[model samples]
Target chain A: MRKDRVLNMLDNAEDNIVERLSVPALTDNEKERLLKMSMSKLEGMSMNINAEEEVRGVDVYRRPRWHRFVSVAAAIALVSGAVGTGFLLKRSGKKPEDSFHAVVSPEQTTELTTADTVSTDVTTELATENTVIPGTSETTADYQAIAVDLMKAMNAAELASSGMLNTDANSPLASDSNYFKIVDGNIKGFDFSTMENVRNFLTDNFSGKFYEQHSYFIEGSDPFFKEGPDGLYARYTGRGSIYGWDKYEPEIISSSEDSFVARAEYEIAGTTFQVDMTIVKSEDKWRVDSATSTLSDPDANNTNNSNPYVSLCKSKIEDKWNELTNESDNVSLDFVFNDLDGDGSPEFFLMYGNGEYNYQIDAYTYKDGALKAIGNLPGSHTSFAVDTSSRKLVLIHAHMGAGDYSWYTMENDALKVIKNEEFEYQEWGSNEATSRQDINYLSKGCIYKIGDGTVSYTQPECPINEIPRSNEINSFTLDIVDQLYASAAE
Target chain B: MTGNEYRRLYAESPEKAYAALFKVYCDYVYAIVYNKLNRVAQREDIDECVSDIFADIFFSYKRNGEDYADLKAYIGTIAKRHAINSYRSLKLRSERFSGDSDEEFASFADDTDIETNSDDRETRSILISKINELGEPDSTIILQKYYYDRSSGEIAEMMSMKASAVRMRAARALEKLKKSLAAAGIML
Candidate 1:
């Protein structure tokens, strides 16, 4: 055994003995100092918690009210059977190709007829080749055709309502004073005169089973419709918006006598996903039974072909890597991509460090079609981990016995600190000293030893366990970075 | 404080609750931190650790939504775990700067045998009992001088005595303790 080991054992034994004996008391000054420190920290944490709660409250209540308006507009457009394409184009100030149009203009209707004839010709050719069932082919074709028409109707309704649905400004529905009413500068409730319109809209498009499952327009479940003495009035429930797809091109995946399933490529907000629509024949008319959407492919949405900013950001990071590696052989550069701001576009965190102590994190995000540096944090030892609960990055700056933990969030296209906690060594002194009194008759030859006036020392105070366990970014080879970018581009 | 009392206090006023909690547990937490870190860390480090423990306790109560049935046990557990982590971190850092190998540090962390641990505990118990027999300021002088590694002058200041007197008492106490241990068939 090493001599140090035996000494360590003795030290441990002494500590155990002292603990068993009695606990030492802190001076009143020390107690007061610690209490003050603790209370200050508590206050800071409380502020952070309150801020988070406020943000969540806004997300839950404020944003959903706008979506409710859009839902009502879509229902109204569907029942009225009016294509507001021209109005939508005028309101959005967007060209036809920039937005989605389910129903083409009168000029394009002739072209659509020719395309439909071609589609019929192709089906006939396939049936002649015995690719489809002999007797059920016609019925299958009819179901598929009906499914496509219904999908188009749904899409047209969404497109028509998109123009009139304004969360920030007064909706056009508010102008129809007979059917709607406004209160407190918001579209608060619908007039009782609109009850018949609401009933007809719900009865026309949805099946009984759909109503049972969704309860979307019901009085009790949705809280959107309430019965009063006069009639049914609308209530504004703060349930957030449901997004509508820009386009859905459907193909029949399966067919039966009473029902058909159509899988469609649903595009929305510059991203493409898949949705399965179930159409069933009810009361001699086909209606949408249910539609389930699949998760979008992130790679498909983030590809260089789709987003030019991705490649730009990748190139910028590569240039930085080369510059860093050129400076020192022992330097390391690593990066991880995350959509910290929930804006669909991912921001990259680049960790640059020397082999020993010096480290830094440089955050870059694509803004205005170019890679822009958002923030950089430098320290002797700096690392970042994701706080999954709050969805923020916790940047840790640690050194020997002192460090800072800063919670970072992307706000207004820049990285900002939400909370910061610091721990460091503290030095304190006690001036308590023992005093001796000389007797008046004491001889001059007598001598006495004096006490040390003060005792002081520095001690490390680290709250390692207080930090949340988070997923930390680990460095990999530059080749892996290249591979990541290449795969994303592909 | 009990968990119900704390919750009630927190509901009434969070600031006052935090103050009450700190006042109750500050000394207990400081003792644990100081005991764990005294050999390796400085006074400020211990102070900071104590404050951090209280802060963590308050934060956890507010944010984690855990109904701590035994608040004292909860506080003690947090204090002990945090202090241990701080100790390991400081020790590892000290070893790194002192040019020690990783293997040496690993052994230092893991090499305590059961037999050796039991023997050490028994011997320390006996040593402490015999030292107590030395009585009064002598036992304190000895403990402060040898166990705490304090200087004679500091021990004198603490005991309200002359430095020379503290040193003399510490020496005599050690001699007496050594004789008592020998009579019990134990060697220091």
Candidate 2:
């Protein structure tokens, strides 16, 4: 074939042809530069890959490669003036080591009669720390800016450790630092223990949704600037009557932009409880990252499910329900405390379920210092959700494959059903060629005529004009109904 | 280093393996890329292509695994592909800069002396002289095919001839070259 001739020509081509056509090679300088660059790039990549482990408090000895690389990088950063090494070195009271692992531990609750604020020596030392400052060496007044930064880190660690702020696992207190030491001490004065102090501290310090699985009175736009008492903090105040602390103080254990820790002590009933608080700086202010308190009593712990208040509420509901129903076996009670009517008071949403046969949903609002049942609905399966924005309560009950959505509103101290809709899935068409399923929604509207004490329901073409009907009864489901009602309210 | 040495280096120290590979193959890759791009790309661009070729080699090992039947062949293939890509991009960029449609650019670009700035003076001159002796578009076709390693289809597009005609012309030119080389007492 002709291909054989072409192949023969290609194979017979002299090796000298390629040798003669060779281009110039790169110089030694270029090779060295590229090799160094590649090594640095690999080092950076490894650091990024192991950043999570570093954040989780893994020791340096475990990651020898990372430790070696970080030591070089940190030294380079210091010498190149990328990070201020002056303050970091000055606080250690010792020469800087290659590893930078000389960490200071915060002392236990040992009170010292020192001023609450940092001293002038702190300012002078911080001034030198900020080498990035213009015009070489700066004065005391010039150091004020970075001083605020250092103070914020200190305050963040202190407040976080003292249990005055919210804390989580991501708190900076867990970070290893060499400069500051967090010493724990409890103040047993009424001034520091007052509900006013706690309210001011929480309101001023916390931002956004710090309370998890807990609700607070959020008036207008900002949750921080509420008009009335905060619900989550009320447990520690006279309003909720759960528990109160005489004084809690977080001592800055050690501080840095990278890491911070605090030793906190809380005084309650002549007993001083110790806790380790993690602090981290956020947006120029120090905040509590997390906390570990030493409260062994299960009852004293608010996080405990077996708390007496919850148990009493459970017993009160169960005792009343047993007296009425005479049913006890295979029964369970669950509750959610939330403001259902936007009235700045939490209403207990209680559910009583007996295996798969009976389910009762109830709403109890605290009035006159006692829990009063505002509404009740019973079915095979049911759910209750409140749209606080619209002051609407949604109750969905499904039985025998048919479900009804009943919307209620607070009227004259009682939850009155305003509108109700019953929906069920039905098969449509005859053959497989043209078969479909459709949702048969029977809508109703409540009307109260003048001078009539009773309300009557009338059929409506579309109970909710905006809510599009589908073959799937998504509202019949618990979570979907809650979301739908929330979206409607929004 | 051999394949076994490379594997050991990769296992012990990946950075060291990368450096060793670069040292062993950098010049080979540079030569391949520079020759391919001498006409279309600048010296700086060629240098960048050489660096990119090695970077591609490093990443390929990362992506496809470190196992290779022939490391030299793998590196050579990457170099060839990278050079081809660079040549194409440079050509496209020049065409775009000139603001010419395909037809206009091809016609205008055909007049350009392909080996004007080529290095390897003695070898290029000998090839150019031999190709010139073939006469008219036949010489251009031979140069494009053998020297530049361009395909017949691309030659056809540039010469405004059918791909089949271009292939036929190339085969005849090669036959002519064989006869000419034989006359000059050359074997291949």
Candidate 3:
């Protein structure tokens, strides 16, 4: 009880403490400067709502997305047929090819140049003024670096010390979110007695389960490092009913000479939360040992919890295949393609659909002339497009209500995904509804990588495209996105 | 607090948010934003970030975002995140990561010490001292937040964090900071 009191006091520290830090009013010039920029930004954003039209001759979303290795096509019919062809077609317009690319423009102004100049970054004047001390440029760099290292050390320590961290204590709904470690693996040097027994022990004591073995495929060029052991290990975090809302905290795993802990941060009900974990040296390699956790605010008030509806939705997504039992205005679908090798044939992709009605993405392989379920990924409704780069098999997907689309790279046989970038614009809902609703759909599209410098995708104008307007959206975001991705990928 | 509570505070009590900023910081909001901006960054971005500093403070409090624990820590994270986001948009952008050459500035990922002795305060002190030697807002706040346990929003309200972070600036700032410091022959 005493400990709880102290912790609670700390949680509500602001309520009891006197205010710190002083206030500075915005200067008149500052106010005006801010207003002008806001207006310009708003104007620019509005201009982009219908900006990306498929490059006139360029084709997008015509090939497999998560398989960049597909350089060899049985009939790689170039959307432009040739690079210059697409370029020439779009070049006839007033906008340059640059508009088709998402290159950050030079006209963009910044504050770092408080010295009175425009730039893409904030003005250099602002950057300079923002310095810790008058000339803390060098010092500031050092400052942030130290902070990063410390956090890493702390994170490492937390991993080593507790092995796992729980995101919510009130709801004891556990999973591998807070903790994932090699509870078991087929290490080459060590016998089953040295490690398998320990693994067996964990399997018996905790709610242990085997995870899909994601063997590390480290390249000589990759930056991430992994030490110890052979084969692969499966891990998961545990959840407990300590708090009102479900929280998955890190779980510890004991290894022979070393320890490895794992935790997952997740978006629960629209907020991000994480579990803590640690791993330490065992007699041989590292193995996980323990976990600690903190609860999130969303779990505070439990009477209105919507787990049943949310869970029903989530479970449908996790399943590899499920028939559409019913339908409503909330139905949405997205496609996901995965290529095991750089070569394109026999690749697998799924149709992931979700929304207010019933969310399901039916993935089928075209074997025996009938499409059969292969996989599924559920979050919200999804929108899909493809990117065929020599380096990666990329799929750009936007889950419903997600401000940004995520990038999933199909390397080896696994689908490695990460949130990529965000773009402006939303579509208004125009589907059948017992109740009227506003939609922000941008999925009315397909992407085609026509050539090295040209690509295109279609984004519907939503209500405008469906109602009164007779034509489909004739815009392409690829010109902008391709430019951005090209630069970033480089 | 609820999101509604946060919205209400942001609307009617924007000054309350600003007041919170004042409480957490002395006059650093402008200083932090100034530290990261180029002339190209418009006032709107800075102002939005400034206003958001407060919103993040309150919402983050309600959210209890833990990548950082204290207000100072949160602000520094926010400011850096915003700055980096803005930098990507800048035309004449100089490589911010180019000049950092300290070893203590190295990241923990590069560090071999997986088993940290959390019980040893001396060990923590060595780390803290190494951080102190690094100096600057990043140093001041990263330590106060990550090492000391602070939140990015609290840091924002204090004018310590930059605006424009989708999530807290990649939680790797401390690791990077430590690597730089260590390279400078400072071992905390």
> Which candidate comes out best when scored by TM-score?
1
lDDT of each: 0.47, 0.40, 0.29
> Which of the two, 1 or 2, has more DockQ?
1
Q: What is the interface root-mean-square deviation of candidate 3?
A: 16.5
* Candidate 2 C-alpha lDDT tens digits along B1-188: 66567878888887788989988876677657756565556566777787776665565454324455456755664565456456545654554445465453342232122122223344344554565688867876765566545578776776778999989999898899768766755544
CAPRI classification of candidate 2: incorrect
Candidate 3, after superposition: displacement of residue A26 in Å?
A: 14
Q: Which candidate should be chosen as best, given lDDT against the real structure?
A: 1
lDDT per residue, candidate 2, A1-490, as tens digits?
1232231222112224433333223446666765665455445544553353223222221111112112222222222222211111112223222111111101211212122233444455554655432432433233343333333433332322222222111111112211112111112211122335544444444433332101222221222112222112211000010112222233445555433555545433222344454544467654445444443232332332433334444455556445423432223343444455667654555555432222345666767666677755442244443333354455544322223456666655556667655432111111221111122112211111111111111121121211111111101112111222222223
Q: Which candidate is the best by DockQ?
A: 1
> What is candidate 1's lDDT per residue for B33-151, written digit by digit as tens?
76566666666777778877888788766753434555775576566546755664555445334545555344334322212256777777787788778888777666666655567
Candidate 1, what DockQ?
A: 0.09
| Model 3 ranges with Cα > 4 A deviation | A1-336, A339-490, B1-39, B42-44, B49-138, B141-188
Every candidate's CA RMSD: 28.6, 30.2, 32.1
Which candidate, 1 or 3, has the higher DockQ?
Answer: 1
Which tens-of-lDDT digit does each residue in A117-211 have in candidate 1? 44455345444544343444445455555655555544433322233211111122332211222111111021112446445444555565544
